[model samples]
Target: MASREGSLSVVIPAFNEAGNIGDLVIETIDAVPASLLREIVVVDDCSDDGTEDVLKRLSVTIPALRYVRHGARAGQSAALRTGVRTATAPLIATMDGDGQNDPRDILKLLAALEAPSGETVVLAGGVRTQRR
Candidate 1:
């Protein structure tokens, strides 16, 4: 059991996810409770597919949404690093920008943590079955 309750931040590393980023962010926001959600940070790896514009438009309606862009193209690791560093919440949940991750699982993952024990939950992986 987690000893202390803290807000959550969702981080996404994106390259060319303009078509998917909007729906992903909206789904994530809907899944997380407003009280527990700190913010959702989307890090753009210098995508040329207008991902930045998508995020910019979404931010107007959702105050909890924030985004950062890399001046040059970087890998996923660098984008993840940027998102984590930009996140303001103590607890951060990372997912793919392509919307493969289900936001509904965020609470379940948080429930599995034991923050007071000085323990860290590094990777929580899931399998995707019956791909269409």
Candidate 2:
């Protein structure tokens, strides 16, 4: 379990995913426990499909939601790098803004990391049964 209320920050790299980004963020917030969640950082890659507008609206209602928009249209890797850099939580979990990745898996991965298996576990990754 996270030692504090805000230990996990989910970094989502989004580009023109305005249609599903809100749903993804809302689903993540609902699926992850508040005690372990710190924030959801969505780094927009200069999406022209009103992604910034949606993020702006969501951020106002969700204090944990942080929005970072790039002035130019950077690729996903750059957006991911930006998000990871901007995140404040000690632990960072990453997922797609299109809702392909399951937010619920975050808890399971965290459990594996904190299991104290008498070995030095640096990271845990979840493989989806059906890769979409």
Candidate 3:
């Protein structure tokens, strides 16, 4: 695991993903080392399928888990923007809320950022072949 002075904030944007949100949150917490992660922010875009309830319940179990809900149904970009705005960490990581993203990838990105390279790399990302 890579160590950093600041923690990483994970931002996830969700719509009506009640079925998948719980497992995603748990997996994300398990995948990220506690020392490296600050918090997991899930932005709910006015999901009607009890997504908020799931997040609230998960928050009780996971101290780092928090969520914000939009009053009206907003687009994915809006939800992501809200999550980023609410994040407290200096470094931010984003993922899909459909549970298709692998949390291990967040660690790889963090490692790359922490790596000592002469050239400055602002960001690193990749596409997963598998789809939900």
Best by TM-score: 2
Clashing pairs in 3: none
lDDT order of candidates, top first = 2, 3, 1
lDDT of each: 0.87, 0.91, 0.89
- Over 43-70, each residue of candidate 3 has an lDDT whose tens digit, in order, gives 9999999999999999987999988999
Give a tens-digit lDDT track for model 2, residues 46-132: 999998999999999999999999999889999999999999998899998888899989888888886566786768998879866
Give the C-alpha miss distance for residue 16 in model 1, angstroms: 0.4
Between 2 and 3, whose TM-score is larger? Answer: 2
Query: Across residues 28-119, which tens digit of lDDT does each residue of candidate 1 receive?
Result: 98998888888999999999999999999999999999889999988999999999999998888998999888888887777667466788
Give the lowest summed-lDDT range of ten residues in model 3: 1-10
Question: In model 3, which regions exceed 4 Å deviation?
Answer: none
- Candidates in order: C-alpha RMSD to true structure: 3.1, 1.3, 1.5
Q: Can you give the TM-score per candidate against the true fold?
A: 0.85, 0.93, 0.92
User: Candidate 1 or 2, higher lDDT?
Assistant: 2
Error of 1 at 132 (Å): 6.4
